[model samples]
Target: MAVLTVPITLVQAAKQGDKVAFMSLLEPSLEPGYRLACGMLHDSQAAEDAVQEAAFKAWRKLGQLREGHALRPWFLGIVANECRTVRRSRWWSVLKWPKSEHPVETSPDSGLSGIELRRALRRLDLNKRMVLVLHWYLDLPLDEISAITGISVHAVEGRLQRGMSELRRLMETRDEN
Candidate 1:
């Protein structure tokens, strides 16, 4: 029998107290973590908090990580879990309330259509929204998304199809109005 060699052995060494190795291991994963957090929470502040918490948790549990090639998805799973935790907290309710006043924006890109599109996205159920962001925005395949979300591949496909239809309807309705 041949012994299998894996890159995560370096990560395991880092988990044993090699700071440089850990930093090297974690550097590439941060942006995706932030994006996932933002998609899950739909608020910049909440997303930042979730990413930070996820980083801390990932550090603490680094030793448990078994696969280096799969590290991105594993870290994203932690960030998504943190986002769920933040969303469930009481503070999230306060954050959820829409503010009465608006800040004037100079960016022409943020037109009425863009605003309506975002509002329509927010109208989606959380699972559908997650599927859309993960598949469409993040460009994850159905199987990988299913792994991260703990849904079956068929369920992921169904959610993506339903979400696309709903989003189309929403944009059309907004245009009509």
Candidate 2:
């Protein structure tokens, strides 16, 4: 999906506490933010909650946003942080159920590979996984990912390479078993 460009006037209005303008500026980012959360958390419900909480936090912290900065990456960064918070909660482990060993029968068009890919993604460490999600799943460029991750472009590139290598190893290992 194409990212929408927010008008500078709208951003100014939002900074000045215009709720409508804020919502307008925020609307386009919600889907991508949710997808980013889902990619990180691997649970749709948790992802939704993370995105919602991030949206609230973004509004509350809007004043901290610097001028000329892009909102999409900023919002996604908030979503990513929220996902991490949710994962770190004490209830996170308690809420997770072990997956069955045997794969369920899926229809021909069900894209079972996608399911397996997500399972493998869940096995990755958060840093590598976040880079993989932001780059591959969200189609974000390295610079934007660097901004969101608070890392250098070189670091982002390294993570992407390592993440892809690890992901490939995991996928190959899965195929062998």
Candidate 3:
């Protein structure tokens, strides 16, 4: 499959210290990066912070991006790494308060299934969760997910399959309750 990418000229210009060119290259990626961060971190504020930090790291490391590489996946890889870093920080666990015993009231318009799905997703280990989010939520192909996660395409497919199975089991178990 043909890989879509920004013009090489723009990347080159960005690498040459052109801030506008950098922003132009970076603009289209922000939303996806934010979404990826949110999926991994499961906190909007943390996600936003992760994305911002990823953007800065991406800018600093733009020169390291190989020619012909798509900026989105590379940027997203950085975002994923940033999310992992956020998750690994000592403050992350300390900051996570226990969930209240009270069940949240859902508005009719708010999809309960979505909420349940997110809860199940949060229960998944980070490896499976990352692949599930990158493939299913982000609609990224296995190869792209592989690139983003720095895993083999086969490994990504395995994780995707296992993640789907686990998610299904989680959903089914929830339904039984």
* Highest-scoring model, lDDT: 3
Per-candidate TM-score against the hidden true structure = 0.81, 0.88, 0.89
**Please, what is the whole-model Cα lDDT of each candidate in the order they appear?**
0.75, 0.86, 0.88
Q: Sort the predicted structures by lDDT, highest score first.
A: 3, 2, 1
Query: CA lDDT of 151 in candidate 1?
Result: 82
Better of 1 and 3 by TM-score: 3
Residue-wise C-alpha lDDT for candidate 1, range 7-100, written one tens digit per residue: 7667777778888777777777787777776666666666767788898898898877776346666777788778778767887777554432
Clashing residue pairs in candidate 3 are none
Give me the displacement of residue 61 in model 1, in angstroms: 1.9
**Stretches of candidate 2 above 4 Å error?**
1-5, 97-110
- Over 4 Å off, model 1: 1-6, 96-110
RMSD of each: 5.4, 4.3, 4.2
| TM-score for candidate 1, residues paired by index | 0.81
Q: Report the backbone clash tally of model 3.
A: 0
Model 2 scores a TM of 0.88
Number of backbone-clashing residue pairs for each candidate, in the order shown? 0, 0, 0
> Per-residue CA lDDT of candidate 2, range 12-43, in tens?
89989999999988998898898788788877
